[model samples]
Target: MSRQRPRVLARAPGQPQALPASLHPVLRRVYAARGLAPEQLALDAARLQAPTALKQIDTASALLADAIVAQTPIVISGDYDADGATGVAVAVCGLRALGAGAVHYVVPDRFRMGYGLSPALAELAARSGAQLLITVDAGISSLEGVAHAQRLGLKVIVTDHHLPGSVLPSAEAIVNPNQPGCGFASKHLAGVGVMFYLLLATRAQLRAQNWFATRSEPNLAELLDLVAIGTVADVVRLDHNNRILVAQGLARIRAGRARPGVQALLQVAGRSAERLSATDLGFVLGPRINAAGRLEDIRSGIDCLLAADLQSALPMAQELERYNRERRAIETDMRETAELMIEDSDAAGICLFDESWHEGVVGLVASRIKERLHRPTFAFARAQEAGVLKGSGRSIAGLHLRDALAAIDAQAPGLILRYGGHAMAAGLSLAEARYEQFAQSFAALCAQWLDEDALQLQVHTDGELRGEEFSLDTARALEQGGPWGQGFPEPLFEGRFEVQSLRVLKELHVKYRLRSADGQSIEAMHFNGIEQLRERGSLHATYRLAINRWQGSESLELQLLDVLD
Candidate 1:
């Protein structure tokens, strides 16, 4: 197969640019395109919107504070993902720091109780003597589950970030920024971010009531490490507010104040805590934590994050590495098989299934397939429920996966048994026999909703860098300019380069030395495309500046994103 060059468009520079004259010109333009003024680029905790701005946060905090004073047994029910794991950790750690009595946590086993605060989960919490139930990363649409908790005599506090349905859960207090009527400045907070906000509010409420007169007030900043890990791992849009949370967390880690578990994870990944960045948090540490949830159980992940010492955290980190390795092996097999399974059909979307596929790893396979094909893709595996299959999907920029699923359900009622997710990703379940039917309906919806242009991939850039600006200083400046992720993407610059030397690396990656028009040479790499994109002459490529570190030395390198001869 030949490599396809995506259409490239450069973002327009910021207007009436108020950036400091001392700022790098290239980065000044890039930051402007992202709508960041010079002052707004500095991430501080003060930049975070007041927690009280979130709907019902005060009420939620009051309830939590009261429960703590009354010595109530609280149980945090979490979903089975990094966000849920970190949310549980933050809630437990923060609550304990606040002097809450008997704070406990339970993460649902995906194979057992499914996601969210289910009725079954509520029963389990009740058995544990939980008088107050706090849900993280889930529960906005869990009407049945919340009602069940209420029936079990548990006061449910829902702290989630997923989009809510028309009918909200009748929980005692809800603290979701996406919940209707919330005027919170940023609606893109991850589950951990919401939990952190709640902790902040709870502290203030206690302080106001003189509850901390004798006790040293817990500095909530200590929990930002988990917040940063979860926010990036969950792949939520890193808006200004979330950037503050993540930047703070990264600062803490680099200052040697990271939680023992995070430190151990850093050690396992061979990442320097002093040089940790958003990329390390998202790609390095996040994957190790997520691996436990994907291959085994998320409880171990939560336990790892909650580990109190390096000695305890190291073993858990090692266990997570094992799980991640297993997950990668399964993903490799599934991805290769799924690729061969693709036919010459003209469907607007792709749906794949295999009875042998592990449900835990289907999401990873879907992400891989979507990246390869640039199509809305879904990968399904057999569910524990008889005659049912669970499917996880990833969407391209122009399509909303969940909305497309909703459309399919609306057109052929009962076609989807259950589903929910964000614009870029979603999960759903249906009768095993309905795979073909659902696929056709989904394709039709995609065809109706997406245009020809939407199907074609496009690579947006921040324009080409001047030869003088392509130095280590410029690269490091860009690194310092971010806590970039998701919505706020790291910069990619496009330019034509003369191939100085090119070769295949380890039979997979494309390695090359390229010279710019001004005769500046730089090392570049494109992973997993050694065969598909080989070119002999000058080529236009979109790339990002990256710091190549080796044996305690650092140099500038380009990570090739795409190329056109």
Candidate 2:
């Protein structure tokens, strides 16, 4: 964690518009560090609202309408992750609300179906007698899969956010913002967001034609809770449109009107939906949604999102909580094992493989090890029956994981076998015997692609804060600004504090009630910092800040990130 902290970025890119003319020092520091200018914080309802004309959405609108008119049998294909599962639920519900009762959905099992739309999935749909296949959160690169679906007499409409390949799929309609030949601003839209907008457009077209005479349109905005969950869970950028969606969903959640599934899930995780924050979504909710893909089928994930009754959702939520627990245990065990492997192996890059490691948890182990070791790391688990190993890799910034694989794909003839993903995260399969070759080639490519600065990790703080500014109102404003996920990060402010006192929290963490050098007091805490402080045998430190909650009340807490003497 020794990366250079940029000296307070004067203009963090893409700051919100129309900020106050004279901001508080803390606000200026926080906003400026996050790439904001005073003019950028223009919090106008008009500026923040989503745009209507998203190009060719009208075509998607017309296509779905025709499908409804002809009563075409349709199936929604989704990934096993939260974004994909919620996307499937959204498409089905939104479509059914518009009178498409012939709709069904399909999700791929991670072990068998793998990721994305493929020939096997097409074959599955063909056998199901589905005529129109709409893939959500996937299918952008299914060039072969699209062709296979067409041959099987299926019309495919893909709403995905994956980076498209050079040869675009031959689908009847493709609605990915990142795909070529199509222009949709906010390239950072998540898969669920794309699906959500497509549904909105479909509804608009139906209303224009007076499709609903007696029946009123279901509150489509009600689905924003799911949309917001998926958007944040998928780790996509929260642009203007997405921020509004997230903000609206958060407001509803705080007001106790989020969906039954979300509400039930909060109860299972011992979190109150009324107190939902982006921190909860990223750390708690996202992991639960991902647990199904990590440990088992994502049916529980989809069920948790689509459950109609709060009571009906409870058992699924309980099971998901169980999965998340098991997931954490397995990830911890595997990461420890992988770290030992790295400590021994003198390799250019890290690639640890084991037949005993749970396959579902390897990606997470890879990510954890990457954070610990600060190198591009890939954790591999053998599919013993296939005589091959599947690996999920994570990398530091500056190195594109997918492009690195593409480079290896070009240089080495048949080494990688199969692969695809984005810059920071990726997946692939290769022969077990070729681990050395693959490891060497990938390491060489990473070193060539990555600079020294990319390997170091640094925390970016919004600004420093004083105890006086830490209040219920300030925290509330920050909380409202929250539900902050990727792109729009939760504000993190650092401040110097004299350690007035400290306690060993279960011997696993440190608890503190601090006072500034000027006699200002602030409640503070440092999770997992007991050992570090004990090693030094002192608590004279300064730390970063976050709000600590208790008994329906909020106060500023200095979360001791690193102990600086």
Candidate 3:
């Protein structure tokens, strides 16, 4: 696959004067460009939107309170990913603290059962003798599963963050912000965020009934550590509500008040809890937890979070680390194969399949291809069932992936067996025999939907850093200014530099000693960028300011994002 040179543009300037005079000039400009007001920069937990704003939250909370009062057996059905794993941990811990007697969880096997709540999963939950079923991160699209659970004499409540289908499931209570008629202001909550909100509402209900008068009330704030991990791992937009949640969680972790599981995972990842950032959560810990669901069972990841002590959790974290290493190897091989397959065609959208590809790793492969080509790409692998192909898709801007899949499904009924996801990412399954048809249909849809401007890759930067601003203090200030992700992006700057020296590391990464046009020498690293550098002379680059800590000292470094002539 040929690399497309992206168009570089500066972000539109913002009303920096509107911000506090104490803020750094760069940060003021950065915040202003994102349209964040001075008050919006405050990420106190108290600033979070009230749970009462969520439609049906009261009903869901009352139902949960009743189950706790009756000492009913409950099962939490969670999706198989980082968000789902953390959400399960939050639910189990929060409910047990709230005086629930019996709460068990069920996660689908990606290889066997596939994603989400299904009739098969419901049967398994019913067999556990659960009278009440609560779904975390899933069940919005599980109409059949909800009906099946109800038929088995179980009351169902769904707490998902995914977009709902045309018809809502007939669960006892649905608490998705994106559902029709829901007035929740933050529609971008992750699965874990929704579960955390539900817990808050349930705690309030229990308090209203004086259930906590005789017993100790649980500090729901203690669960924010897991909430932060899941929210960032799931890659949800960091709206004001989410930023508050993550900020609180980070404070707890920094204060050494996080759960044993989180501490143990951080230990394994070699990240310091005191200086952890949202980037660490997304890139360092998220992948390790998600590796379990992708390759083996998500229960391992959940068990780590549920562990009572670091000694008990370390082994599980190590297991997750092993799974992550395996996942990386599988992803690399699959990506190479996909690149070879798409070397010939220049379709607006891309679809690739290999019988040898692991079903669990297709999503990562799709994400890699989509990032490289800036196209909506799907990668498929043969499912456990013969003649079935399971696929995962990642989309560029201007394409709603789930909506695109829905359009294809509506235009040709029976083409897709199952599908659900968000705007940028989604999963689906179809017959292996229909691969060609689905490919052509997907390509046609993307071609029809995307225009030249949409297809062209673009990188927006926050202008350039002044010579005096290129310091460790500046990097630290920028780092402190964000719990950034998705909609709230981290600050990126563009500049021209003369390459003083360059060296290739392991034949993949390029390490450069560069002299900025302002005559300051700086260190920069371009990971997996050996191919992008043809002329080592003067070059334009977009990068993020970073603090590189080694041994005991920290220095300013630039993490290159893109390079241009």
Best by lDDT: 3
What is the lDDT ranking, best to worst?
Answer: 3, 1, 2
Candidate 3 global lDDT: 0.92
Query: How much does candidate 2 score in TM-score?
Result: 0.92
**Tens-digit per-residue lDDT, 124-173, candidate 3:** 99998889999999999899999999999999999999888888899989
lDDT of 2 by residue, 335-428 (tens): 7777677765533356778788988888888888776667778989986348889999988768888988898999998998889989888999
Which is superior by lDDT, 2 or 3?
3
Worst 10 residues of 1 by lDDT: 1-10
lDDT of 1 by residue, 134-153 (tens): 99999998899999999989
TM-score for each model: 0.98, 0.92, 0.98
Off by over 4 Å in 3: none
Residue 132's lDDT in candidate 2 = 89
Instruction: Tell me the whole-model lDDT of each prediction, alpha carbons only.
Output: 0.89, 0.75, 0.92
Query: Where does candidate 1 stray beyond 4 Å?
Result: 1-4
Query: Candidate 2 — what's its lDDT?
Result: 0.75
Better of 1 and 2 by lDDT: 1
